[model samples]
Target: MIKGSIQEEDITILNIYAPNIGAPPYIRQLLTTLKGEINKNTIIVGDFNTPLTAMDRSSRQKINKETQALNEALDQMDLTDIYRTFHPKATEYTFFSSAHGTFSKIDHILGYKSTQ
Candidate 1:
């Protein structure tokens, strides 16, 4: 968890990695369980490993159907992708594959509706 505060408000950010490409169901369940631990105003962030686009080939890993489905699950959960929102440019890359030096925007900052 990434901890930070703005003024008097405290926020807890969660960093998660779904080990498998088809792990959305498990991930969503985990998020649901964790939601109770966080305050309504807390901010969640990290590498979800879910790709919002199949065309986002800005990395070595190929964006497959499972990734796209995971992205949809995140959307359905109402998680806001802060980086993409602030940076509309497609050149933004976050993760680098050392093997291929391919960079992709897999890292993200997501916030609860109350905090955002």
Candidate 2:
């Protein structure tokens, strides 16, 4: 977590790198911890490893526990994906894989509903 002032208003920034191997449990743990730190002025950014939705990837992927946890966390926290909030139908991506020959947007920026 980083603390600073933006336009004289105090803010908190949290950067994360969610593990792919244990994403389900890690997301659950992260959400538990975030419940205490997240606020209107908080911003969360990360490479979540798991896409929050099917549209976030270029290939068909099953809905897994990790994705479920992330989605639930957003609802419970009242957090919105900053990019998706603005460009709901966009097909942009942030990550690419050669071996799988697929593209996915695993990175995200999120903030409270009232923040944007």
Candidate 3:
């Protein structure tokens, strides 16, 4: 997890990286638990190992229905993807499995809407 604070603000950023498979439900539960523990303005960032669609993937990337479902879970939690804001023109790739020869765009930075 990435943890840091800006200047004098109490807001802190926490980053998480969930496994590629069977991570959506757990992630949603984790988010719910974290939300209960931290202030409303806290920010979360990470490689969720899932995407909203094939469009969210790179030319060499592949995604499944489970991955799409995970993305939907994030949306249900009201998390805002910040990578698009920071690097609109750049493609973010977080995982590369040399053994499988598969490259996926699972990395991301999601923030709580209340922070902005």
Instruction: State TM-scores per candidate.
Output: 0.62, 0.89, 0.66
Q: On residues 1-116, what C-alpha lDDT tens digit does candidate 3 reach at each position?
A: 33455785566677777876776666776776776554545677777766544545566355566655666666677666677656666665666768666555666667755644
Residue 92 lDDT (model 1):
60
Quote model 3's TM-score.
0.66
- Residue 83 in candidate 2 has what lDDT? 90
Please give the range of 10 consecutive residues that has the lowest summed lDDT in model 1: 51-60
Question: Per-residue error at 63 for model 2, in Å?
Answer: 2.4
State each candidate's clash count. 0, 0, 0
Model 1, which residues run further than 4 Å from truth? 2-5, 17-26, 37-40, 59-63, 98-101, 113-116
* Best candidate according to TM-score: 2
After superposing candidate 3, which stretches have Cα over 4 Å from the reference? 1-5, 38-40, 59-63, 114-116
Instruction: Give per-residue CA lDDT, model 1, range 82-112, as digits (tens).
Output: 6666665666666666876666666657764
Best-to-worst ranking by TM-score: 2, 3, 1
Name the top lDDT candidate.
2
Output the worst ten-in-a-row residue range by lDDT, candidate 3: 52-61
The true-versus-predicted C-alpha distance at residue 45 of model 3, in Å, is 2.3
Cα lDDT tens digits for candidate 2, 27-113: 668867768888899898888776777788899677677677768878888988899889898878888988899888889898888
Instruction: Please report, in order, the local distance difference test score of every candidate based on alpha carbons.
Output: 0.61, 0.82, 0.64
